[model samples]
Target chain A: MKPFEDVGARAVMILSPGDNIAVAVRDIAAGEKVELDGRAVVITAPVLTGHKIAARPIASGERVIKYGAPIGKATAAVAPGETVHLHNLTSDYLPTYTLDEGHEFLKEQHQ
Target chain B: MTIQAYLRNDGRKGIRNIVAVTYLVECAHHVAREITYPNRDSGAHLIGFPGCFPNAYSFKMLERLCTHPNVGAVLLVSLGCEGFDKGRLLEAIRASGRPAKLLVIQDAGGTRSSVAEGQAWVSQTLAQLQNTPRVEMAIDELVVGTICGGSDATSGLTANPAMGRAFDFLVERNATCIFEETGELIGMEHWMAERAQNPALGREIVNTVAKAAKYYAIYGHASIGPGNADGGLTTIEEKSLGAYAKSGQSVISGIIKPGDVPVAGGLYLLDVVPDGEARFGFPNISDNAEIAELIACGSHLTLFSTGRGSVVGSALAPVIKVCANPDTYKRMAGDMDVDAGRILEGRATLDDVGREIYDLILRVANGEPTKSEALGHQEFILTYKSFEPLGPACFPSAA
Candidate 1:
């Protein structure tokens, strides 16, 4: 296996070729421009390291691809460089469990 | 490569000769804990099933654990009135040709006396274990298991895949490698099935993951938790892909449930989810439960990958913690054995960290203490579960 540096020197990584999202290898600040493929994609929001960023615009209800497979569906239209997380992307399987502001168990269901 | 190991009468080898102080029910836990406290640094580990009611799964798990290769001897602590079958468990332990003793807290004059007697037995057993025969144990004689917990996205990108690389190395050497947590592999079934040794085994693999999915669905929760979401894992499918990377690229040789030891050396997938209806609350209550299941299946040691950072180690087996997130690694360096996050930082390649893990496994097998072991993290947990016998396709390669 080649070193990760051989892939690219970008702050974000596209795990697989067909993946429409890139994972932040480092914490990326909002409005920071990072190159994906040959084009520059501006970060719309601050993305933490190990979080996902939209590589390209994704339509609502479209499958969100990662690890070369569909991880879930986009809950709403997503712009390039947007953070793809529980707020915008929902699991196609069971609901993701979370806590409400009051620390009560909240089952976040897919839209 | 070979390391000096304790050879059991059953022909299995062990890296540690641990004297297990086990309680049969929740009532006896305190007495058992007291018995093992003085010998905390001497390999006398406290492990038990807390359920007062009888469960066949817990009984089998305890039996397998008592006779596990790593365990040198066992001391059973029972409350006398509890429903756990202490007699059968003691008999099974003695039948394995290991020193076994039982302390009935009621008949032995309750808590104080039971604790005293149990401690005496533990002290004696630890001494006797020193005489266990040392033999040359090769890599093929090893049974290694992998599980990912407290996972983040870097877990898949770094530690999980690095562990996968290490698993591939061990499998290539003809060692037994087991990766589990079917619930975490919900969406990767088809991808995993394609790597099975046979079409039938492939089908069985698919069905196993389906069972996990159904079980989790019944509880209205995927295995993904708030901690997982906090670490940026959105869906169970996304987490599944990350968790699945720990299996490496080996052709999955078989599927075995808890306490079902693989008959031969190869890569195996441990089916941890219960078989029947979703009577159990969750497949595994926590990561330690899964670690206990792996130990019951005869793993000499376990590879634990984490990005969010977990400090747990097992009673019978040594856990090599691979920190996946670079920031987490920085925060929890003392708790981790391998910093797989170096791959993410471009400081090391996957192969580099993979080799580091593989080398550490050998060193740990040769009697080197892992970070957790040195820190006294012998955490163990077991609970109720039911499983039907494995279908023939589950272990086609096993004799």
Candidate 2:
């Protein structure tokens, strides 16, 4: 495999043949340079391992694909190598289930 | 496929001949625990719910567990007025052709005598089970379930899919494999439905996930935990994608609610969340609750994949721990059964690890104690929830 074809060269892994994002296999520091699929993309932010990074430039409102399926929608245009998380990506199907934010829904149940 | 088994009258074959001492309510837990304490190493297990209010879901769970292929005899400890339906439980056990004894704490002269009677009954039952006769059981007779606990980034990427591979292998061999937690499968149902055996079953799969989404939306939460984010999952959908990996690539045969046995021997989605409005808070309070439901569906053992490392095993069933993260495995190797984290290092492939897990299942079925089992981790829990009776489609041809 070519250096870029091997995602492990950049410490990332692609799950599916049709995935639009690759998961960081190791923490990639901001501004780090890595070659993905034969193209150079600079890490735009500190991306932690197991988190998604845009495999290509994704437009706002575009669905983020992982494991060859849509995981969520991009809230803002995300450049390749940009970390895709809560800031730029939000769940397309349901609201995020956070502990603090979800307390209100369970207030009466807890009481 | 044939192995030494204890055949129950109901046609269910047990891999272990254990005497289960169960408390009907939380009040009788002390006496019940004391009864099984002295014989902790004798395959005498303590299992019960702590609620006094009668719950149909709990009733069915206990009934199925008492008659689980692993249990040979059952001793029910009742507080007398806890509304746990002791008569129904005893009747279910007797119907299965297993020896059952119910000791009411109120009538058995309270705590001391109840413990004494329960201990005597357990010893007698154990002695009887020693001669209960072992029959030949086949691999197709085993029911297994998969669950993810304390998930991290590596879980979905490594351990879960490996478990999925194992599930696929077991399913092909005609073993029943169940994967649950609809609340966790929130967003993957659309794609997941396509993997079903038929269009109707696919629709049922989607509806179950949708029901979970609706149920959790009422409480504004998903089944994803706090440790999930720390391990790199950003949303429930992302987490579900990982959790879904445990189902493997087999066609989902049907969707069944808690306590509903699989109608066929193929992949079945377990709908853990209840229908209608969420009246009973969150569906599954912890990982053990899901395991209990899996056992209720006739699971002889469970495959538990943990990315963050969970050291729990079930009361009546052995749990094979598959660790997803190499780092966590290094720290908690004693509790894990498979080093699935090796996949992350590129040292092993999915098929290689999957085969390892599949072999472990057969070995454990043949009387090998899992790490959790030998360490004495028999965590059993049941919470109150209401399940609507499933119609014909849910049972398929085999249930």
Candidate 3:
């Protein structure tokens, strides 16, 4: 396992060689430049620690790869360094559930 | 290395000699709890089936729990009119060679009287348990289960994989290791199948995961929760890949369901999701349900990996908590056993944490109490579920 400190100075972590998303090791603000695979990518949006940031531009309907496997499919085109999450990516196998404004569970279908 | 352990009649060894106070139905739960209250620190634990209606799965689980190697005696509390077959359960417990007693609420004169009667039985049983024989238990005789709860992105990166490393170390030493939660392992079937010992077992792995996916799909929700999303996990597949890391790279030996003891353990995949229709609300209502299922399968202890953090320990076995996120570990260090998040911080390597976990297991097996155990976390929960027996392909090695 590569230590976070050795990987691009610990800003973000790319888990495996084929992973298209890098996990933010620490909170990163928008407009901050982070190194991925030795190349710097400008952050398009603020990313919280443990949240995913795109390592490369991804087309809509493309598989989002992490841990060298497909975690889900992109719902919209994603730019490099953009936050990748519920708003833009969805699981290929099951519907994800979240709370509504009233704190009741509401199911979000995969598009 | 060997540790002193309680030897059971069935040839299994245990790290604890606990007196179980079990309730046969929901009505008896209160009385049973009251009975165990005063004797709580004396290795007396409360376990029970709260359902009034009979369930084969619940009955089988409770019977196995009562006969678990960790238990030296059992006291059954029953509400007389419930559909549960308390008499048969008591008989099963007695047949296991452990001292067993039953108190029917209606027959024992209701609440106050039943609690008093149950407490007397527990006290006597605790005394009897003092004489339970101790034998040397080797590493190979150990059955260890691993689970991840309240997970986040760091869990996959830290605690889970570190646990996977510990599993590898244990499996290499000929110890029996089990990892489960097929519902959380939905997208990783093909990878897991590749590690199966045989082609047929590979097919069984795929089919088992397929069953879990179907079960969750029917419920219109995956195992990934709102806490998972809030913790930065995007979907169930992502959560699955993270959860799957706890299994390590051991060759898949067999697939067993709740209450099915592994014939000879190397590595076993526990299918927690029920068979047939989704009669139960979810495969596991909470993390404790999964822990109970692991105990029912004869696990001596469990390694629980968490990022968001969980503070639960099982009644039948000890739980060692591995914290994945450094921040959470700092906040809950008193409840956590290992700080796997050190890998991310570069304070320690995965192998370092893995060795620490393995050594801690031996210490715990030899009579060390984990953080949760020390804090008096004897959480227990059992609910209704259904299952069919395993097919021949589920255990290719035995075949």
Candidate 4:
């Protein structure tokens, strides 16, 4: 059987079918070659571990897919073999509370 | 493996027989802590609510904790004039056929004398607990809860799925498994409901998640922590998909609010975010708060999975820490029990780590110390909140 790492983010992982990105398991320097689906693509930027790599080309405002579902929307045009993160994509859902805000909110309520 | 257990009146079995020192309000906290801290070597731990304001949720959580199967006795400390319901709490503990006592600080001659009196009583109760009868405890009678903390990309990819596989094993053996934090289960509510034994139970799952969403929105926030984004999670939906894997593939039998016990053994979801307004702030201030709720609901032991690393155990129940990231495990090996990160490294498969967790539960119940227990990591917390009792639709299997 193929090792589970090949399917996981050891090098890269596609979480679900028809998804737009794969997670980088290790940091790959630019100009290096990485496998995607069946073919090889040369890295355009230094991709960090745990960051997303574009599975295909997409236009701005397009939904970014991970785990086969929309995690967020692209803020700018993302090309294949590029990294996906806060610098490119943004969260569709806002955070419920921050660490500092929670402290303040708790203080106000109890006081 | 069969475990020699402590039988309870409710037909539940306890793995640890502990004496709990409870402070009814914050004013009595110092004296209560002093009474318990030194004797903690003999199985004492401090747990209580600090709020002087009366809260039905805190009251119920206190009742559940004092009567928990893991707790063999309790010492109640109260500073008079607080809004907490001390008498009702004492009655519940006594009703459970365990030793329980209440000391009002003002009547007991203030903090110094009261500490002396509380110490004597704790000593007496602990001696009595040594006589509690031990019978046979088996896997089928076990109730387990899984929680994810400091989650990161590795959490969903490795540790959570491993936990899910272990959960599947427990459910098959007729054990009750509980997975919670509906706030984190934001995007996959419909998928979760479809796995419920009955259709109405599914709808309850949907409603509870919505309650979490609405509750968080009012507070101008979401459940995903900062560590989550630092580890590459971008949205609540992405974090949720990772969080939901802990339940495995069992058909959910019930949905419960905090402090509500299960009627039968199967998979259950705890609806933690409260009903009504977001006045109490965040539903769970930290991971320990959720762990406390699980102990209050009769969990014999808890499975804690973390990606960024968490070192917390609990006051009444043993907590097993499952580490998700290989790198994190290497850094905090002493604090973790199982390295589920082996799944992603290909050193092990999901089943390998899953079986490892299942084995750890049996060994811990039979008196083997988990990494948390051995390291003396018993942490506890409870806060004020409100809730309406979960409805019949939430527990259709019991009907």
**Best-fitting candidate, measured by lDDT?**
1
Summarize candidate 4's per-residue lDDT along B224-309 as a digit string, tens digits. Answer: 76688777776788888788888898899999989998868899999889888777789999999999998877788999899899
Question: Clashes in model 3: which pairs?
Answer: none
* lDDT of model 4, residue B40: 84
Cα deviation of A24, candidate 1, in Å: 0.5
Query: Could you say which candidate leads in DockQ?
Result: 1
Q: Alpha-carbon error at A69 in model 1, in Å? A: 0.9
Q: What is the lDDT ranking, best to worst?
A: 1, 3, 4, 2
Which residue runs of candidate 2 sit more than 4 Å off their true CA positions? Answer: A1-10, A29-32, A42-46, A99-111
Estimate TM-scores for all models: 0.97, 0.93, 0.96, 0.94
**How well does candidate 3 reproduce the true complex, by DockQ?**
0.52
Report the C-alpha displacement of residue B84, candidate 4, in angstroms.
Answer: 0.8
CAPRI class of candidate 2: acceptable
Q: Where does candidate 2 clash, by residue pair?
A: B14-B69, B263-B398, B263-B399
User: Number of clashing residue pairs in every model?
Assistant: 0, 3, 0, 5
The DockQ-derived docking category for candidate 1 is: medium
Candidate 4 displacement at residue B177 in angstroms: 0.7
Which one wins by TM-score: 2 or 4? 4
Estimate every model's Cα lDDT from 0 to 1: 0.89, 0.84, 0.89, 0.84
Give the candidates in order of DockQ, highest first.
Answer: 1, 3, 2, 4
Tens-digit lDDT string for candidate 3 (B158-244):
898888889999899888898999999999999999999999999999999999999988888799888888889999999998899
Ranked candidates (TM-score, high to low) = 1, 3, 4, 2
